[model samples]
Target chain A: MSVVSLRGVTKRYGDTRAVDDVSFDLHENRIHGLLGRNGAGKSTAMRMLTGQEVPTSGQVRVFGENPYENADVLSRVCFIKESQRYPDIFVARHALEAAAMVFPNWDQDFADRLVEEFRLPLKSRVRKLSRGQLSSVGVIIGLAARAPVTLFDEPYLGLDAVARQAFYDHLIADYAEHPRTIVLSTHLIDEVADIIEHVTVIDRGRIVMDDSSENLRSQAVTVSGPTKAVEQFSDGHEVLHREDLGGFTRVLVSGVPTGRDTASLQVEPVSLQQLVVRTTQFHDAALAGSGNGNGKGNGKGAWS
Target chain B: MDDARPLFQQIAEQIEDSIIDGSLPEESRAPSTNELAAFHRINPATAANGINQLVADGLLYKKRGVGMFVPAGAREKLVERRQEAFGRSYIAPLLAEARRLEMDAEDVKKMIDAWRDDQ
Candidate 1:
């Protein structure tokens, strides 16, 4: 069942619609990847969902009830972002203590273990910590909070590759034992491609793609061969991207028929990152072709 | 881990490879979904889906409160099925590449003989 649902949600700031008529569901005990480029309104949508920012129009529902100013709903939700702020005098330990008090499911032992694993300095002031150390503080709180509905928005801002891998390992290990609804919003799509069960791609305040990761994995393929043969094979499919080099042509096409004969063409699978990029570009091109001019104008150059 | 197919299918194939290679013998307990997920660093739901596919195919069976187990003849059955698919999976590509190089079946047969002598 869907634990959280947004219906026609629109968050506007001044003249800009940060999140435009967005509607999607977060199912129970599943990991959802919210992905998009910078300035694509991913943060705005996340803020509205966490009740930090209310939508100008439409509804934001968590656990079937409005999350705005609802302590009961808020307690069950944990929003961790890269820009999380603490008091000037607060130390790392104090932050953990504060989180332990706020979250009913907090585990002090888990938090302590994470503190050691990340090599966090508990006595140091929160502002004095290094960038990676600061990110680890948020990561520890987010993990040990164990909220039923946890949302992580770009939680690995300054973390090194090793630290990020450690975080993913810990997350998978802990989540296997304690399942909960998780929304991970990040630009590192390939890193979490296997970890996430569902994917939602947002672009310019609109959702361009939303589906289970498994379904999206097989949705597109890249066919490269002689221009005529490649074009003929991808004739009926939705071409998301195309590149030409002399007589050779390559196209990324979606909705390809399974088991189609491709004896002359080189067929390869499209990675999740490539799929998201191509889908966004395809959406942008469609908008620009319609004379809307609302897109970022990057789409018009992709066709060449 | 391959990008060419769904992750769950890859997980299932990994388990199948273990079973076929005698590492995971028939009648032995199979890895739990959590074990697979933690080992592969993938979502538990995806690992569970992989296990469910094997169960649906009758290669693995549940012991009800115990855990999943490879059936008695799972290895043999898997080997037979893989052999059936060898033509499409391996030989077809081999022939396709040979055709591209302007080589006939007789040439491929001679090349295979030469490769065997080298081995």
Candidate 2:
């Protein structure tokens, strides 16, 4: 079941269309990676879903209700962003205490436990905390809130590697006990690739790819060897990318070959990060080509 | 450790690895899917899929409301399967790589002899 969904959602900031005609479901009880490059409309799309931003044209649904100004939906949804601000006078506990009041399922004990683990100084004013510490405050609230629909938009900005791992560990562990719909946005694609069950890749305000991570993981592969052999192996496959180095040819294919007759070619699976990069690169090339210069290689160059 | 196989398959193999190595004894409780997921930094569903595959293979059995466990005689059955699969998994790949490097039968024989002597 879909706990949250967007239908042809378009969020335009005056002349700039941040998100355009995007549609996908945030399936219930699964971790989703809302991934893309900077300024790729990820944050804008997230804002609309969380009721923080109104779409210029389209529908945003949370629990079968419009999320905008709907307390019923907003109470169950928690949107944590990296640049989240707290008043200068508010201390670390003040912020978390405020969150506890909002999320009905909030656990103060868990909040307190996470604060200690994250090494956040409870006494420090929110405005005076270091970047990493500031990030911890948001992570603590997001995790402890136990909201049914939680969206983390690059939730960790200045957090160190250790803290990030801690967050991930707690997230999966906590999620197992209490299943919910989670949409996490991040540029560190490889780290969350395995943790996320589904992936929705947005590029230039468009839903370019939305599918189970398993499909992406199992289908995408890199076959490299002698030019003819690689080409023969990758024939009739959706080749996402190809490269030439002297006599060798390497292609990223979206199909696995039948009967491991992979004698000459080395078949390697493409990592999630590689898949996302190649896809965005392909999408960009098609757009730029079609948007300029006779549109000669627009479609042909995209999948070549 | 770095293999191109899917995450769930790799996870299933890792559990099988422990079983084959005598680390996870017979009839012992298998780690919960959540435990494995957190440890590997993977989705719990993937870990569950891996465990479920093992359960389907009779290498593991589910106990009601408790957890998955290695069945009695699971180790022996797993060992037999591993032994049968060794040639395809290890020797075939070894020979393929050797052939790629243009190694003749004599060169392979020498390398095997040296490897056995070292062992």
Candidate 3:
């Protein structure tokens, strides 16, 4: 079932089009990844989904109905941001209490367990919490809300390696018990790539790629061989990315290699992060080569 | 949870999942390192390391001539092992944290009830 859907949605900021005519369906009880480079309109798209930002055009639906100012839908959705802000006087317990009251399906026991697991200081005010602790607080609330649809926007800013691993473990363990729609938007693509079932990649205010994580990983492979053989094999194939390493050429192609008589060829599946970075970079180069397309080339060069 | 354990330990649970789901039936040949590596986009060495860990634990055995196969009675053993580890790994800390938070047994039950009511 589609828990969230966007059809021809566009969000504009004065002269800037933050999100342009984007459309996708997020299914229920699956973890989805929303990925993009900075300023790529990922955040804008997420905001529109949560009704935090009004769409300039087209439709946005959550749970099969328009979510704009709809308390019933909004109440069942929890958006955990990178930097969660609370009132200066609000203590950790106060926030937890407020969450318990606000979320109709709040799991206080789970919340309290998470508080202890994260080692949250209940008496400490929100402003005094460290960046890692703040992220933890947001994660605790999002998980404890038990909302049908939960969106986490870059919730691991200052978390150390240990803390981040803890977050992943707890998320998987809890998710096994209670399946829900989890949309994780993060730049640490490699970290959550394994847990996500599907992914949507946005670049330059448009949806460049959206597919199952399994297919995305499997559909592309990097083949490295003699430059001549590589070029010959790559002919008529959709090359998502390519790299020249000394005398050898490595090309990431979208599709399995078959019927090749070349003896000196090696092919391997590309990592999810590698695939996304290479794909977005490839698109950028194509756009730049066209010269008239979305022409805001920074010239620092794309993903050297 | 320490970083010392290989990152694939976190993913090895998936192989266990295959066993539970009958994807890799009892005594059936397990996936090869290259297959797993390609399927997961992981380093072949890391994939082998995960398989080796399971091999060391006796959940899987090598046939030498034919690759690896799930050990007989592996599923039952895994269940027993997981149930045993669940006590110290999950329940103990949970109860300790609850007691430390001043939540008595009755309070814990009440909290569960309130959560049910809210849902």
Candidate 4:
């Protein structure tokens, strides 16, 4: 069942609609990847969902109730962002203590273990920690809080490769034992592609793609061959992208028929990252072609 | 693991490979969904989906409160299924590449004989 649902949610700031008419559902006990480019309104949608920001229009519901100022719903939700702030005089340990008090499902032992694993300096002032160290503080709290609905926004900022791997490993291990609804918003699609069961791609101020990861995986393919052969293979399919090199042509097409004669063409599956990028570009090109005319016509040139 | 197919499909293939190689013998317990998820560092639901695929295919059976087990003759059955798919999965691509290089079936047969001699 969907634990968090947004219906036609629109968060506007001044003249800008940060999240425009967005609607999606977050199912219970599933990991969701909320992905997009920078300033795609991911953060704004997340803020509205966590009750930190109110939508100018539409509704945001958590556990079937409005999350705004609702302590019961808010308590079950944990929102971890890269820009999380703490008091000036507070130390690292103080943050954990505060989280432990606020979250009913907090596990001090798990937090302590994470503190050691991340090599966090508990006694150091919050402002004194390194960038990676600060991110670790948030990661630890998010993990140990064990909230029923947790949203992580760019939680790996400044974390090294090894540290990020440790975070993923810990997340998978802990989540296998304790399942909960998780929304991970990050630009590192390849890293979290396997861990996320569902994918939601937001662009500008709207959702461009939302589906299970498995369905998205097989939704598109890249066919490369001689120009005529590639064009024939891509016939009647939704071509998200196309590239030409002399006589060779390559196209990323969706809804390709199975068991077709691919003897003369090179067919390869499009990666999740590639699919998101192409889909966003395709959407942008459509918008430009339809006279939205922002004059940012970079993606439009590729179509012709 | 690769982007060529779904992760769960790859997970099922990995387990099938193990069973076919006799490493995961018939009648032996299969890895739990949690164990597979942790080992592969994937979502538990994806791992569960992979296990369910095997269950649906009758390659693995649940023992009700115990765990999944590879049924008797699962290895032979898997081997036969894989062999049936070998031509499309392996030879089709091989022939396509050969055709691109302007090689006929006779040339491919000669190359195969040479490769066998080298092995």
lDDT of each: 0.90, 0.87, 0.81, 0.91
lDDT of 2 by residue, A1-304 (tens): 9988899999887777788889999999999999987777899998888888899999999999999899988999999998898888999989998999999999988998999899999989998999999999999999999999999989888999999999999999999888898989998888898889999998778888899988888778899999999888888887888999999999998878777568877888788888987887777777886783222233333321
Local accuracy of candidate 4 as per-residue lDDT tens digits, A1-304:
9999999999877877778899999999999999987777899999999999899999999999999999999999999999999999999999999999999999999999999999999999999999999999999999999999999999988999999999999999899999999999998888998999999998778899999999998899999999998988888889999999999999999876576667778899888888988998898878877876334345534311
Where does candidate 4 stray beyond 4 Å?
A258-260, A293-304, B91-118
CAPRI rating of model 2: medium
Model 2 misplaced regions, further than 4 Å: A259-261, A292-304, B95-119
C-alpha positional error of residue B37 in candidate 3 after TM-score superposition, expressed in Å:
17
Candidate 1, which segments miss by more than 4 Å at Cα? A258-261, A291-297, A300-304
Clashes of 2: 0
* Model 3, TM vs. native: 0.73
Query: Which tens-of-lDDT digit does each residue in A1-304 have in candidate 3?
Result: 8999999998888877788899999998888999988788888888888888889998999998888889999998989888578999999899889888878889988898888888999999999998988888888988899889989998887788887777777676566567789899988888887778789998878888999876676677788999999988878889987789888998888786679845677776678888888788777777777773454444234532
Candidate number with greatest DockQ:
1
Model 3 bad stretches (over 4 Å)? A292-304, B1-119
For candidate 3, the per-residue lDDT at B29 reads 93
Cα miss at A70, model 3 (Å)? 0.6
Name the better of 3 and 4 by TM-score: 4
* Candidate 1 residue-wise lDDT, A1-304, digit = tens: 9999989999887777778999999999999999987777889988887889899999999999998998999999999988999999999899999999999999889998999999999999999999999999989998999999999989998899999998999999888988999999998888999999999998878999999999998899999999998988998888999999999999999977566668788999888988998898888878777875444556744311
For TM-score, candidate 2 versus 3, the one ahead is 2
Cα lDDT tens digits, model 1, B15-116, are: 999999999999999999999998998999999999999999999999999999999999999999999999999998899899999998899999999999
Cα error of candidate 3 at position B27, Å: 11
